[model samples]
Target: MNETAVTAASTAPAWLAAARAHANRPTLRMRMPFVVDGEDVGSVETVVMDRIVEHLPGGHRLFFHDAAWHLQSANGNATQAMNTLAQAMRELGLNGPWRNEQLVVCNEDGKRIGMIERGLVRPLAIATCAVHLIGTAPDGRMWVQQRAFNKANNPGMWDTLMGGMVSAADSLEQALERETWEEAGLRIADLQSLRHGGHVDFQQPAEEENNAGYMRERIDWFSAVVPAHIEPANQDGEVERFELWTTAVVHDHLARGEFTPEAALLLADYFGW
Candidate 1:
């Protein structure tokens, strides 16, 4: 191999390490399966469960049984019950930053069970879905965004062109289109060579919540080519700014831990670095 190829081969491990660092799977030894209507939906840390039981409304029917936490007597209104519990938890300061958005809760088989507040997903260790878009300029430079400084999580970190949660009301396709427009001010139909880039599953402690919350997310990422004449403008105010960076510059930022872990994982997988 030539000198450049040798150097590239030597640095590939670092990229893999950076991505793998965010995939720490949770051990359920200290947690209990949160079951709804006889379906196990999530794994809640024991301490978090205790806090929830203590703060949940008196009318709620969440209880521990059969070695799992189960909601009893929801009467087909499990969504409402979960929302009530989530709101109560938030009121008692047991949840993460409240987004006032609802996320679909699903069982292991990906069956939708109910909906809960977005902020309570981590506290309850519920698996959530998100979409990320990776944009490349006509010259092959990647478009990255700086998160708003006041954001609740990973503030000021560089990220993929656009990334946002798949809200309860959106399908994967709808989320892709919506987040692209909201975060980048670019319509999906206007992009070139749009393609699905697979997904990455992340399970880690939510550092923003001081490790009191757990994050289990599946991020479906896509990539597209942005026309040179089109510039990305932030419409949602969640993005501080956007910059087009060469592959080398992105790699440097990844190595320096300047990118959010989720973004780093997707970018590394995209580049096969």
Candidate 2:
């Protein structure tokens, strides 16, 4: 992890500066193709990674065979082979309520290419979409959440008020509404001034060897104002706790490198950096 402090001299918050630094870092390219005995079976995404071989769950292994990175599997059937990989991830305790969430697959241009399980997407290196809701109160304080300790990705890190992948069957609105209610106990009605903020393209090397090999996603960002009277109560167990922080405090954490990379970017974008 790059701990080099994003210089505080800039007008932009330190968190946003750090996010920019992360955005500029180099990535290792990887291919996720389930090849058995030298025959291609299905969809393949070029995964950007920090390393090639990771120690993720299950009995899966990636090896250079026949001049390519082969995700070795016992099952030759394509569906079964993918399942084998998903099962392994579950075993590693990466699976969550969003585990089987089906998300539309896309190329770098955001084209509707196909669909895949959310939990399996990273392992397969497929590009997917997600929503992050930046909630603010009338007091001008922003709301943030601490991710559950068991989360498969960026566990225990600070995150936007709400975040979740846009599943294959869901519209952008539906994914946002669902995640808001589930993660922060906010119904669509509780959120005011709802608007599409923007998007962030994030890719990074996997942190733990037992985690999904690479982290990649296109974040569809949203911002809203919630009633000061309504405190965000988490319905799902994905959040550890919620904190309402002044803008300056957030910048401090970002400078200290405490926020999750994605959340830092989202916060920075929301603040108009």
Candidate 3:
């Protein structure tokens, strides 16, 4: 065997060795579609990530949540997958104890608003499972947010919207309402939650393409479309700058590394682009 093969063999865990031997091994991985109110979550992974985003909103955390059903579907590699994930995370500079922290904070009631996944539950705003709110101008441009400099994970990166973790009190609508107000000054009262969009599809990143094991859970994806021009109040604390964009602009921006690799993968999968 070659040096790399010998090295990999030396470090191979017993479980993976067993898993790999079963060539016809069926990676029994899949997630139930997540939805809220009426909207269908287009991608489960994005929605789960969005659920965990947190910002201290005048003491109110704009909590997002993942359905337990969906949560159980992803990362089912069990101990073996975990070992591989840990090794990969370490090699990729995303390892460390801090990576396991939860991104969302629940209310006093301890409701399940959202959870931190990816071994480290980073938070995000923008509802993908239920009612989604997209910011745009008169044209068909999409508005995006540049993550603040003080941000730890994606500092200097841009996103579909800026959001934070919050308590899971009140209804999902109330949470979104609270999130909109917190991330950017906007009231979504009388807003409509888009219903029914699940069985989310996955368009994995290059590395994940052959990783059939990693794609078990289907991230139900959902997006909300706001009818009017959204003028979000700049919450300097949670956001950097906001700009309206066309699909073309977003396409280029994504290509230029404006969004995090994970976010980019999700956006692509969401639109099935």
Candidate 4:
């Protein structure tokens, strides 16, 4: 390999690497408006245009209004509105049992603004909370997992050892503990300190994988060291395998755009890059 390759592998920051991976990915510019009791809250993309049109009262195509897209509604019940939209997506084959989890909704500042069904949150461009845990072995190797090929989003991509969206009812720490046990089969208390390593706020327009209009997320990052004697096995089938990689190896994958953008961000933060 040339010096450029070596330097790129060694020096690239996680955020920059993730940005580069998404730099070439296509974004859907058009946003279908989401309104609640006349208050425009968010927008969805064209992927679910048919479903929205069908369920909307008048079957009106989304139109631009006040610099945002919107659908007409007579009612203002948030729960009913969310349930109706979620059902639409489900019938259209966009969401299912596993992907249709509950997620915490928040504003840009990361406050507990509201709650929504996870499957509809993305399309509506609602901000959601996610937790990522970085597991490190005593000898300095990072534990990473490959997502199962059948996952709804970012399938077949490399990801942090354990990560999941936080439900509306779960706190960040609680979500971390549950996700850790589910994804890696490790009880939180069995590991070393689950240190708070800061966070990453990611807001990007919808890409191809996001049939939902966009992805706006606030991720709480954590790191822990796993003893060599302890092995991580996947309880949920979302992960295919787990392996230990050096910092350099991780960076190389980042350069190659192998890790999911969210995973890249967590790993980058973990490496202090």
Q: Which candidate comes out best when scored by lDDT?
A: 1
Question: What is the C-alpha lDDT profile of model 3 across 1-273, one tens digit per residue?
Answer: 112112223332233333223322222343333332223322233333243323111222222355421222132322232233333433444422333423332222344344333332111111222223344444445667777787655677877653433232334556556666767676665333433233332232212222212222223333444456456666547678877776667767766767754445445544443
User: Candidate 2 lDDT, tens digit per residue, 1-273?
Assistant: 001112222467534655776764433543455443344432233342224346533454556555445555454433444455555546555533246666665545465544446666655555567899988787667788999998876789888999988888889899999999999999988777788888988766544433344556779988888897789999989999999987778778777777888888876766656
TM-score of 1: 0.91
* Selected candidate, larger lDDT, 1 vs 2: 1
Write down the lDDT of every candidate, Cα atoms only.
0.83, 0.66, 0.40, 0.70
* Deviation in Å, model 1, residue 80 alpha carbon: 0.7
Off by over 4 Å in 2: 1-10, 29-98, 107-113, 209-212
Compare candidates 3 and 4 on lDDT and give the better one: 4
TM-scores for every predicted model: 0.91, 0.72, 0.43, 0.79
Question: How many pairs of residues in model 3 come into backbone collision?
Answer: 38
Q: Pick the candidate with the highest TM-score.
A: 1
* Candidate closer to the true structure by TM-score (higher is better), 2 or 3: 2
Say which prediction, candidate 1 or candidate 3, comes out ahead on lDDT. Answer: 1
The order of the candidates by TM-score, greatest first, is 1, 4, 2, 3
